[model samples]
Target: MGASQPGGPSLPQERRLVTAIPGPKSVELMERRNKAVARGVSTTLPVFVTRSGGGVVEDVDGNSLIDFGSGIAVTSVGNSAEAVVRRATEQLQRFTHTCFMVTPYDSYVAVAEQLNELTPGDHEKRTALFNSGAEAVENAVKIARAYTKRTAVVVFDHGYHGRTNLTMALTAKNMPYKESFGPFAPEVYRVPVAYPFRWLTGAENCADEAAAAAIDAVTKQIGAHNVAAVVIEPILGEGGFIEPAKGFLPKIVEFCRENGIVFVADEIQTGFCRTGEWFACDDEGIVPDLITTAKGIAGGLPLAAVTGRAEIMDAAHAGGLGGTYGGNPVACAAALGAIETMRAHDLNGAAQRIGEVMKGRLNTIAEKNPAIGEVRGRGAMIAIELVKPGTKEPAADYAGAIAKACHAEGLLVLTAGTYGNVLRFLPPLVMPEHLLVEGLDILEKAIAQVTA
Candidate 1:
């Protein structure tokens, strides 16, 4: 038996494989998916999930795989959490979609109130609801531009905001995300980020130097006056779980504050106790002018929010800041339920425990494996950057081999980093400690077998 949280009954939290990774049933689903689904949409493990919760995803073939990726950090409170299921089910019976913009709803206001209270800082804040992380991010940019009436937005290297047109421009990657999707929004600038692992001078000098470079680029190249916002992921998400050097974030935040540029923290993947804190920015006590949230906000429902200084969030005209289905009553209910689960389970502390376990185990693995470059991140969001045996060069293929091996063993994991050489883990905060330990064991064994 695995640990259980009062947040509700979760899956057994065990890894059970009735057949191969992509068993016959999953293969049938895969065949169907290939025919109907767009080719642009790709599957990672290629198994159709029948059900999921706590720490495992039950595939169509009866294979219950340990879930290390919480549907890209969306199921942090755990799938079908009691409050979530109960509230969402209740809302479903009552009404599903009465757009907030048209009629408004109490649950939507309730969610905004929670976010205002939970997010970093005690300042008066306002929140606008949206449907996805991308939508929320784009809206954040718009709000910044509207409030400041500026044209340029500055981002950092290895930052990932979203897939929308403006967000694609905000994103630093090229191939998969922004390859052919050109004519992207203008005035988006990319700057250097303090990446301690990859910094040329060394980790000791990373914070000061990177911050200087970033600040220099902003002032000299983009001119802070023209910059509407400076968007950054406190810990790089898709670009690898690269936590900026201890002092880097504060410097940037200070710079934006001094220069009148809005500091927008893209907390979509790092918020909601996923990072041990309510928001990653809270770790450094660096409060952003605007914060974007999604993924784990509403249990498994699609919901996103942008909470910020009231003046900035309210700058947009009333009719300008909403969508047809933004903050659907059902989704708002789910968000409230998800928040209840977070509080009930003390998921923040659970994330801290996950970080302790994952980092300790991965660091131990790194001590023995020369190919494992660096083990870094906070809370439940962690990653190991793969590199050549003796150098900092990314070992992309090595990462792929390791991930493939884990998948073969019924352990689902995801890879990230601009070089595609990082194995990122975003386990549910309610995941059983046994599952966490076992997942690390599988990862360690995979590394050994690959090197063998």
Candidate 2:
């Protein structure tokens, strides 16, 4: 990561803190936000971004911070890549919206075609667009139910789908995502996930034991015949960057296929080039019956899609599967640009290189600090689970403190986990190596400060 991409923003690629974190201007903005915005919508860093491109985000107070979150894995390509800006600007000049449902557009169809061609499996496929990951997941469930003629849907522990009524039921977290928002959709069941870090049977046995437990739960509790689909994240996002044990996904997919249950991969966070592949499932050669994508799909534009086997996707009624803003022309243009940029830059390889650098640095840090329970993930989607020294007990406070310290030092990082002890890194694929190493330096200092 040398510098900004060609024709990207010209801002310097180094971290510079002119004022305290959430400086005076940001504090004033926060006051206005508190008065006007909903209290439920929270801010992580609260610095108020004014400009951003490549690896740096500039705040209103003139602070340039190294961005490691990438807007939660949405901007795999740099935020203002030339293609994304040019395409979206052209599309905006042409038209913004005509409602794809009322009057279909070529951009929407083109996006669908691209998804069909790019997604795993050579089988004939169809795609439906949506405004968010939750909507894609909701539609996927609908398609599965329509195709399989079943009601119950199965998910795994520590999996995060979305925040809607149905998705809240699909998501496993209970505090911020699912608390009091209940009366959630029914007929959703949760089963064991192959989490190697915390699995009692040991890492070697995690995949087999967890898969067997999941299969048993579905068969005995939900009844295999009643399951419409088995939904899972290739790598859990908000639930922490937990990569399932090797061989677990294949077993679950096989069981789903045998039971006539549709297999859905929620690739919202792990899709595109975030995991060094087109999708995380590709690592194990697992092609889901339905794949839901968002986040990195459109280089920060609000767009999500579900791509699946043709017959299954076509099961929904003609008028039952679209929204007003689904595949909005501008978003479609942005997605096309994002896809083009991914190929042009070989962002998949970039993600792999980033992963190599990060994993090497993080592993070294882990070796020096016993509080880091584990260093796990693939490509740029990596995380460190913090724990008490010499024990597996979660140290959520330590994780939070480290993240805050990084923020204060003008390096933006994010935290996750069911127990809230994971510090995850999702840097843009366009980030320069120097910035990444610099960010890691800040993180090391923060971790040392917290653990000491």
Candidate 3:
């Protein structure tokens, strides 16, 4: 066991491969999973985890792999942070579930108060809890439509909201997310995003030109007046860790304000200190009319929230926004614990430090490898785009090969991007600096071996 925190469980921090990638125990579990689990439910790494803490996940076969994905940015304070475990355990011992809609709980109210205080704007905000990021996003749209009395909603290119019917229509990607599952919700509009690397006009004009084009599309096609909300991921997550051009967000927010369109920030992946700030929008000082959160909100618990200005949120009738398990007491307790851990450990600052270490190391790797097209993102949410040598053409195969190599070598990494050519890193904020450097070292070797 590794050194224990004040009240947290201690797991070994070092990476140790006791057997081939998927040891016999994991192989047995894989067989069981194939028989019991649905094919639609996929996994990045197939190894079955027995214990995980800090920066490492130990599989059933005793292989401790460095966790770089953070369960897709869900465990910012590590898998078993002391505060989270303590509060959640206490809540579990007591009453577990009492639907907040039927009998409201203090923990749910407390979590709401925290979100209102933490989210960007301070103009008397309100919050509604949900079960997942998709639910929060769907509810945010509901609130926006109710408040605006309009039907059309606008989403950007390379943006990912969720997998729900409405969010599927809102999402930009097609292959796995939206393929063969169409018949999506109507009145949803798609527009170009300020993607600097892929912008045909050049990176310099990406921010201004993309914003102008998107605004024009809304004005001409959707007629702004018919649009209820302009929902965006400040730092695109599953669509790729594509950070929009610096000034693009402000421009879009300004346009939404002028058009009376509610600006919604789907910070599901980039919120709660994942982006070195409370929310990615803070980097640009963009105050969204509504904000959706989930992944890291409750220390791995299934909890999500939609927070916004009181006036807009109150537009919905009393019973318009809630579910049976919307704010389960146990999950609310976990959220409170997670928030406490974030504040106590300064995970926001930790994310910034992680970014500094990752970017510095990855940039050096990029300089040596021509396949590395660009290294972008802020704080702990960073990624490297792979491309054909000497050209911008995406090298998705190369990215996949590198990710596989990293996994084989005991470093778990994930791939993203609309083209599937970007290697994204979302290490837990509590990860030790040494582990980060070691993981980067493994990544460098994997890149070298694959490229060679």
Best by lDDT: 2
Off by over 4 Å in 2: 4-9
What is the per-residue lDDT of model 3 for residues 160-254, given as tens digits with 9 covering 90 to 100? 99999999999999989999997999999999999999999899999999999999999998798999999999999987899999999999999
Regions of model 3 farther than 4 Å from truth: 1-9
Q: Each prediction's Cα lDDT score?
A: 0.91, 0.93, 0.92
Give the per-residue lDDT of model 1 (tens digit) for 86-145.
899999998888777777779999999999999999999999999999999899999999
What TM-scores do the predictions have? 0.98, 0.99, 0.98
- By TM-score, the better pick of 1 and 2 is 2
lDDT (tens digit, per residue) of candidate 2 on 19-47: 99989999999999999999999888999
Residue-level error in angstroms, candidate 2, position 223: 0.9
Give residue 220's error in model 2 in angstroms.
0.6
